[model samples]
Target: MAKAKPNNKVDPNKYLKNKDIEPEGKLGVAAAVGRMGLMLVGIVGIATEFFRDDGWLKAALGKLFESTSSMMLIPVIIFVLWLLNRWMSSESKSETKKSGDIPMYAMMAVGAYYLFKLITTGSL
Candidate 1:
């Protein structure tokens, strides 16, 4: 019987000590950019659809919410309250607030306004 030959291939992982570092090669950069482009396109498309007055998404949401009777606002209120709690309770004690929190603050204000209006007028 013939003896088996030894495998000579080197394991690349043995040389790569820091796996957390991103590859600096052209292929890696291209792949990263391609992924970012796809994500940006998808986000833009969704935003456009949401902004359009006659979009199917808006129409569908309107139809669905019409029968819910203030139930839809419950989730929005809960989410805004959660965001406020998270922002206030963050470990980092930074004097300046993040720009991302602007949208959350706006949502909280709007939700509070609607809640106040609902209580006062007894209508949506």
Candidate 2:
């Protein structure tokens, strides 16, 4: 009896085997340009505010709030980003993941606390 040959055949013209999928160098340049554009817009906004004839002190205090708001938002943003990345990377599509909810809930609780405090203190 003749031995049967194993079927290991694959199509050579598949999309994965195509040579036209090379990474473009312009992608990095486009990313850098986008970042620079954001930076320029931010600088322009700040300059317009600072050079205005209105209250300089209030402008300065507004800057302080901007920085403080960003600091307060950083952890929440990080938690959300982590949760999204984890969900995206999970292999079990049918089952839902629940690892990152605690941080998000905690952040919300903290925000509610601050909001309540502000309202109680007549600062809101």
The numbered model that scores best in TM-score is 1
For all candidates, the clash counts are: 0, 0
Off by over 4 Å in 2: 1-24, 55-124
lDDT of candidate 1 over 19-101, digit per residue (tens): 67775999889976755554454455455556787886888677767776655886887899988777756566775557546
The TM-scores, one per candidate, come to: 0.37, 0.28
Model 2 per-residue lDDT tens digits across residues 1-124: 9999999898777666667676758988897665555445444444555577774657655665687675676678789998778764556777655754554455445445545655689542
True-structure lDDT of candidate 2? 0.61
Q: In model 2, what is the error at residue 22, expressed in angstroms?
A: 13
Clashing pairs in 2: none
Shift in Å, residue 60, candidate 1: 4.3
